[model samples]
Target: MSGWALRTEGLVKTFTLHLQGGARLPVLYGVDLSVASGECVALAGPSGAGKSTLMRCLYGNYGAEGGRILIRHRGETVDLTAADARLVREVRRETLGHVSQFLRVIPRVPSLDIVAEPLVARGMAPDAARAEARALLSRLNMPPALHALPPATFSGGEQQRVNLARGFAPGYPVLLLDEPTASLDAANRDVAVALIREAKAAGAAVVGIFHDTDVRDRVADRLFTVEPRPEASRSAA
Candidate 1:
């Protein structure tokens, strides 16, 4: 709710395709962006424009080739782009949360436990975390009978709901979401929007890829468009 919770200065990323004679594919180049606490910033662009790639870079899943990904964590600013692996892990554990388009969890873990794991890792009692997870899943309209089942058995929409519940549960200071409502129906999408608004109101800086314009409009304070640099420019670089 004060200064910027996240900022990227001249961020650059490229993928080297070993299969294609080490062709360098530049996805992000000198991308500068910022999101203040209590703000929701939407990344908008055509498909394959690197929206998701930027989110992953911000989350430290993908390394940036240049520039800084500055994140405010525990009252300190750390550049994730250059931070050590341990520091990045600590930041992710205590300050950043991410919700991806797909659900990835241990194959045999129950949906309830899957949603509660973050909370438990952060020192919440297992019972309390499970209770909170159950409540969130219920709010998302997940059936009670399916709570004990593994998310692997759930439908795409249902798995997405579980993913959302987990990402929102920790209430981290910074959140990166990639199509958070991608597999949802209208009703569930509305619920997801409400949760995003609630996060912003609570002073979480949110950066997201929202393909659904209506949801983007409802939650985004601003938009950052990712445009691929021309091939000629890449070669020159």
Candidate 2:
């Protein structure tokens, strides 16, 4: 196998505007991206340029209109665009990890359990998973006291910490981070950067959208610009 861990060929995505008489809005088209193992690729683009859309598509959250989203899974390259829901879930469990901008989990679930759930799903014993979660949370400055409580009432920074710990704990080969450090303070931001660097060192392929130039410079090996297609951006009535 080559060094590339993830790549997309001619990827395209579109959204239908039901409120606008079912008009079609195109976001991304003909996107060809490649990321290697142990590298971080930052998505650079304007606010309306569909970087998030592309990220969601890459993660199989949004079904692509066309193209192939390929990633190395279990030593084989699998096309996520062609994968079934079950295969996608399996891939997410074993190969791909994503840290979105917000923490979304079952309401009232303790922060520790929230972070440990993924590990448990991956076959780690619950006790061991929670132990790993606790250590990671502590490293992110999440107090032990707060670990037992639900993060629904936590501040933005605190919730972000739980999200980070959960996503990084699984040791996935491919990671997608959407503004991982956006809500963090200086100290936590530094820790986030360190975690990213550590992941890369351990051969995790990372793709992220970091508006913070400092964070981008620290972690991104290169930038892939998502240029807006004016025609696509315009809704067809």
Backbone clashes for every candidate come to: 0, 0
Model 1 TM-score (2 dp): 0.97
Task: Give per-residue lDDT, candidate 2, residue 28.
Answer: 90
- The count of backbone overlaps in candidate 2 is 0
How well does candidate 2 score on lDDT at residue 202?
Answer: 99
lDDT of 1 by residue, 1-237 (tens): 349999999999999889999888899998999899999999988888889899999999999999999999989999998899999989988999999999986889999999999999899999999999999999999999989999987899999999999999999999999999989999999999999999999999999998889899999999999997787977866
Worst 10 residues of 2 by lDDT: 228-237
Cα-based TM-score, every candidate: 0.97, 0.97
Off by over 4 Å in 2: 232-237
Model 1 segments more than 4 A misplaced: none
Q: Rate the local accuracy (lDDT) of all candidates.
A: 0.93, 0.95
For every candidate in turn, the CA RMSD to the true structure comes to 1.3, 1.5
lDDT of 1 at 116: 94
List clashing residue pairs in candidate 1: none
